[model samples]
Each structure stands twice: as C-alpha cells, then as structure tokens.
Target: MKTVEQLLQAKGHKVISIAPEKSVFDAMQSMAEYNTGALLVMRDDELVGILTERDFSRKSYLLNKPVKDIQVKEIMTRHVAYVGLNDTNENCMALITELRIRHLPVIDKDKVIGILSIGDLVKDVISEHQFVIEQLERYIYDTPEI
Candidate 1:
C-alpha cells in the first residue's frame, strides 16, 4: 500500500523535462544522461507530452527519420496518463498496464512533481512482498507446537 509520496521520498523527486520544440536528439541525450527510459515534454512548465525510447525506436529508427530534424512533439505521446502524490503503487501499475505505457507523470495541483516508471512500481511491490514473507516465516517458526 505504498504511496507515490513514499516512492518519491525514497528516490528523490527529480523530474527531467525538455521543451516540446527541442529536437529528438536532445531528448535522447537527456534520457541517456539521466539513465531513464523516458523524458517529460514540457512547454513553459506545462506538461505537453512524454518522449520515450519506444517513440524513438518506432518513429526515428523504424521510420528512418533523422533525430536532428524531428522534434520531440512529433513523436511524443500527447495524451499522457498521470498519477498523483497520494496515488497508490497499485493504481499506478494498473494504469500503466491498461495504457501499455512504461512511464507515468506524477502531478500535484496541475504541476508536475515527479515521474514514475513501471520499473519503480515493480521494485516497490517486490520489496513489500519480500518483507511480508519474511515476517510470516518468522511468525510461523516462533509459534509453539500445537
């Protein structure tokens, strides 16, 4: 039952965004530098879209479009699915699965706060399950013979 706030607190809330007018090449470079799979496309602090590696592969490589010539807005997903700080990891996972998207932008009062990746949600769920299993094992072993 971890919240997006918990995840952001565990992993500092740092959002990497690029201007919509920027070239795809620039967005790719930023993704590399951040070691992230996606980057938020912003225009004057507004969440316009999201540019991801998949977009690059599908639009740039497969289509043989030059990254330098194409803008992020050209390939980014305009209708982005988002989560809020109070949202649960389960909710995030469900949205990601339903949308078949790997990233979700976290917003607060119409302002972009953080970005959550499928990887992040998976990692959190795994860790929570592990903790619960360990607790169960300890309880079972510590119980007296009946």
Candidate 2:
C-alpha cells in the first residue's frame, strides 16, 4: 500500500513545465531536452493545463497547423485530473484508467508537487507483484518440516 507521497520521494518530485504563452515548438524542444512525454502548462505559478505528444499529433499534425506559430495554450488539455500527495497509488491508477489518461499531476494546496505516468504506476505494480511472488515461493518451498 504505497502512497503517492512515498513514490514521489523515491522518484524525486521535480516536474518539467512550460508557460502557457510559449510556442508549441518551444514545448516540443523542452520535452525533447527533458526526455519527457508531457509538460505541465503553467501560468504565473499556477497549473493551467498539460501539453503532450498526443496533443501535437492529433491537433497540430493531423489538422495541418504550424507548430512553431501555435501556442501551447491552444492545444494543451485544460481539463486535467490530479491527485494529492496523501492519495494511495491505487487511487492514482484508478483515475488514470477511468480518465483514459497517461499522466497525472500531484497537487498540494493548489501547488504542483509532482507528476505520475502510467509507466511509473505499471513499473511499481510489477515490482510489488514480483516481490510478493518471490515471498510466496520462498514460503512454499523453503519451509522446514511444517
């Protein structure tokens, strides 16, 4: 039953963000430099929206828009789903699955604390399952004359 706070602490809470007024090209450049799939859209220290590769592909590329000229605020997803630090990983997973979203921002009193991705949740779940399986195998095979 690991908490989001614990996961954040383990993974580091730093998140890459960009201003809403920045160009889509700038967002892409920042994403490339950070090697991240998404960027938090911020305005005056407030989380405004989120820009992801999917947004670019679907909105800009498919629509034949100029990425260099378009602003991030134009294509970013403004309606975001978020979790808090005290929330359980289970809640995070549920929100991701229910919303069909890949990333979720962790908030604390209107402040962005961290970000979580589907990959991160999957990795953590797999690791925990592996540990449980190993423990079960050890108990079943290593018990002495029970």
Q: Against the true structure, what is each candidate's TM-score?
A: 0.94, 0.94
Model 1 Cα lDDT, one tens digit per residue, 89-140: 9999999999899999999999998898999999999999999999999999
Model 2, 4-92: lDDT tens per residue? 99889888899999998999999999999999999999987799999999998888765466888899988999998999989888998
lDDT of 2 at 31: 90
Q: In order, how many clashes per candidate? A: 0, 0
Candidate 2: regions farther than 4 A off:
none
Clashing pairs in 2: none
User: What lDDT is obtained when candidate 2 is compared to the true structure?
Assistant: 0.91
Let me know the TM-score candidate 1 reaches against the reference structure. Answer: 0.94
